[model samples]
Target: MEIPNDSPVNPEQVTSAQERGNPADMAQSGDFNNSNSKKKKAGAEAGTSRGNKSFSIKLAPATNLWTTQKNGAVKLRMEETCCGGVSPLTVAQMFQETVNQCGDHVAIGFKQTNQWETLTFAEYYGECRKAAKSFLKLGLERFHGVGILGFNSPEWLIANVGAVLAGGLAVGIYATNTPEACKYVAQHCEANILVVENAHQLKKILEIQNQLPHLKAIIQYKFALEVHQPNIYMWKAFMKIGEKIPDAKLDEIMDSQMANQCCTLIYTSGTTGIPKAVMLSQDNLTWTANTAGKMVDIKRAGRERVVSFLPMSHVAAQMMDIWIPMKFGAATYFADPDALKGSLVNTLKEVRPTAFLGVPRVWEKIEEKMKETSAESSTLKRKIAIWAKGIGLQAGYNNMYGNTSVPCGFALANSLVFKKVRVLLGLDNCTKYFTGAAPITKDTLEFFLSLGIPIFELYGMSESTGPHTVSQKNYFRITSCGKTMEGCKTKVDKPDELGTGEICFWGRNIFMGYLNMDEQTQEAIDKVGWLHSGDLGKFDEDDFLYITGRIKELIITAGGENIAPIPIEDSVKSKLPIISNAMLIGDKRKFLSMLLTLKCYTDDETGAPLDALAPASVVFCHKHECPATFVSEVLQKNDPLFQKAIQDGIDTVNRRATSNAQKVQKWIILEKDFSIIGGELGPTMKLRRGIVLKMYKDIIESLYVD
Candidate 1:
């Protein structure tokens, strides 16, 4: 079925039966219509001054309307029930409330010295109090930013909350960032104090410390006692420094914090250029945590457990692992950094968290592992697995389309195969498994759904407090990022003929703006408070949003035909298991071309060879094993058989293209795959198109030379 891309269903268009006694119905039935018209008229009259103010043609209620303003901007105000009840003003208040309610409950858990360690809410709060006092003693002032560079740990969370309690801002530095990148963030935020996890992070700071005159001290969380340097305080000694100050002093600092004040500076992952510091206020954090929790129906008071492993510098990690847990008294287990590469599967099995948030790559790896494991079973077992999966897919589809009843043989299939798969994936107890940070292929989404695991795909950026829209339980679309959250407004600005346009937003969760970058900030948020997201997207009749591509990344051919490369790239990669990455090229050329990278056969960490094979070969072999010669020959770029496999994959993907312009006309398979260390991919695995284009300019030109 071809998906329709338009604004959400209008309240006026809704059937009477669906709208009966609904708030949306009440909004559309009265003077509200006239008021809306008047507002549009007023906006139109002042359109000249407003500049391109075009009011939306549909006039419905606030709950179901996408109202057009005089400035020609379309706006959809979400329903109010989406918003959560009264939330605390600041992180300090949230901490105090959680401590009072669940002081003895485990707040943070981690593995240390081959055994698990934990800290209770009361213990964590007490640590924060001491840290806040220490910061005060170190001359930290209101709104002064403190930089934390490390992996996820109890100390990282404590220092972050402590900074806020001390009336200061907490700035997280990505652990994978280069030393120069680290210096830029610390200098840009003017961090007064910097905290490092160990000598590795501390060394990065020391290399550039001379350039940071504002940095007064450096604290090491781990291996603190072994280090000796001027102005370098150990974690234990740092907390002791705060003990010298009276408890009343720390309380006074916490009391002075305001809801609207900025509490943290989260830098954007620098995929395109230098990272920009996003200032999220106390209100933004609390509101998002409370509101998103309600929308997803997350259990509170230590009932919910989640694995914390994603980079804390990312907003999603902060929102899920820190804010949501603190707000709802959910226990969070910090996954060990060392075990992340080799022991994640065992960790997930052991923890069996109720909620899991993973990027698309993580899910892809899990899916691959499942395939490998299942392939090792007997022929009969494999057939049963396949048969069970088909049944599960039908059940999942029924649920997605709002059919509550299960298929006749679904229970048997579940008990026989699906249940074991779920157990193996460590999702037996999981209620919510979310995938975000980048676009997930439809193939990946459906594969999990077929196993009775609904992996919800959400949409948001650092500017929107992590996620403003998410696919709800049993209410979702195949490729959509779901509907707007409560108290949030979204619109497609000046949509094209196909109804695709830049997605704009307005909500309390919108950021305070980039720190010390006023001109750029003004360019993002307009005078009326709407944040102009650079990404192009479309909305269906059901209000489900489908992100197409970035506005700047759109390719306009010489024939004047516009193309979105993401869907095409995703389609190509999904069809070819042997192809690791694909990038479309034809911005100002006659036709489309592609630059593809092949998959690696060796394990990234262990240096062991894997049984990676092309889809065609996999189907023929039936067994998981590939011939030794096949693996060796495929690694060579000039191998004819390997080239044939790549060409066949491209042909399959081209068959699905809606238009001739979307098909790849020419292509070249690169000798290497993109990696974060190579600067071709970002931390979240998003392609740095500009960088890739620049790096492969010669190769790209070669395809068009003919």
Candidate 2:
């Protein structure tokens, strides 16, 4: 799909910007030779070639959009080709195309008044346009921000698209962020408007309103306003503000949009330091959505459905829940605000979604819940399930190993057990199961596989527009992240003997750059224009990517041996079935140690870890002839039997360790499990290494003491 040649900016003017010695402009225009240092230019060419040699398509020329970075020095590094089969389109253009094709199809489903409420594609787009006009009437400026802090609701999406439609950047603030974090993002993005889901989120904004000088107004999309103030409006009242604004004015802004210009700001949930705003362009979102949808064979007939419950502030969630669905005209059902607490499965059953995505923690919870239910079955039923699972496991392995033949009795097993299991979990219709944003153990993968559900893993960061490599149907490995996308390129830079090195990416999916962070941007995208992912990984012979570790997370012992924590932690967990979390310590100490948290019951409403043991843990304890109910109870009593069992598991893990430095020499069990509320995990349930270290500093010091 060729872009029209009727661009308003003259090619001559863009050439002038490159000649003005602006480094960013030179990078975008592919004028590497014009650099002062010839060595730098040569390296850039070599790096570019190494990154894009696998792809054959010719890239479209950079347009005026490439030079339109008003707030920062961030610029897109020109690639040899656009994302394989996608045209460079703005968010508004993409939405319109879907609306034209599926006007009457259901676009969104939300629960209201104890019933599912529906919005057609045409109606969804119409509401967005109305919201856009209101944004203009409320003084949203070009290149400024419109911060939306809330759950995944129709209003959140509408406000997001509306901000872009009105020529402003859409900034999604995490609903879990504190008032200070909200202020940092709002102030950094120069937000002109803030949209909250309800009074709870509104209260946060109100506390920091004085610090956000650029914020002009606030809109509460849910619940009636209990406190009235100037420039604060309810959802209906806010939508009416732009009634006097002309459609032609909004249309002009839409027409002026370029795919390469920034439209969204995704702030990273940093493990340490302040969050940096990741500047994503219109092309980045649209190209990734189109190419990724094609990679996974997403249907465009409006027959696809998905459930949105993950935090929209995350790149993966936004791409899967909002961008991809919008691209394919799929209906998205908004799960309850407390969906992660326990309600997501109910929505999944009601929606019968065709595709589903979850973080590793979410999938792990599902696995545990299924195991709990299975334990209650009668002897005859248990025998039948065991028999069926054997066939399912073989069939699952057959597919993973590229064996097309189905195992004998597979059909019978599916009819008897797998089908029933899927129905019980509300996933009878789900064809794709995705897990990402954190490492998932092989045990969990196999557990789901035994139930005839294969969870494909995706690998990427916020900088890559969610996924750079995707494991999909007919192209997946059990423990490896699959091949790079069609139009993208991945380079394992400076590989050692094992071929593991930093995973670098080059493609249209790369972000424009961090908003207003020139130094950090330069550190990320090198002179060769490849975005350094900071991840350590190597590809197999089949080009399947295996993530070994991250540069920042690698532990270096006193003996100078480097070790990756994930593999060791995974090993410990696999050996100890009762362990919920295991963190490897001893980065600069004499020997490695670990911090372990036992599996325990969690609050169904708040998701906090309760004192009682989980069902699986309870069963494990009973089998060992040591009955324990709470984690605190075991620690308080210092149960010798339980301690021996845990030590036995650690010894088993040590037997598999490669060297003395890699083995855990000491260990301690935490009183509670790691969780989002405990401040040990991020919003997506990813481990926060820095936070964990600070919180348990004394415990760690004690382990190292003589």
Best by TM-score: 2
CA lDDT scores, all candidates in order = 0.71, 0.78
lDDT of 1 by residue, 5-85 (tens): 122111122222111222333212211111233433322222122222222222112231111121111122223443633
Per-model TM-score on C-alpha atoms? 0.70, 0.72
In candidate 2 the C-alpha lDDT for residue 430 amounts to: 82
Model 2 global lDDT (CA atoms, 0 to 1): 0.78
**Tens digits of per-residue lDDT for model 2, 158-188:** 8998899898999999886778778889999
Off by over 4 Å in 1: 1-88, 224-227, 554-706
570 Cα displacement, candidate 2 (Å): 26
> Candidate 2 regions off by >4 Å?
1-85, 554-706
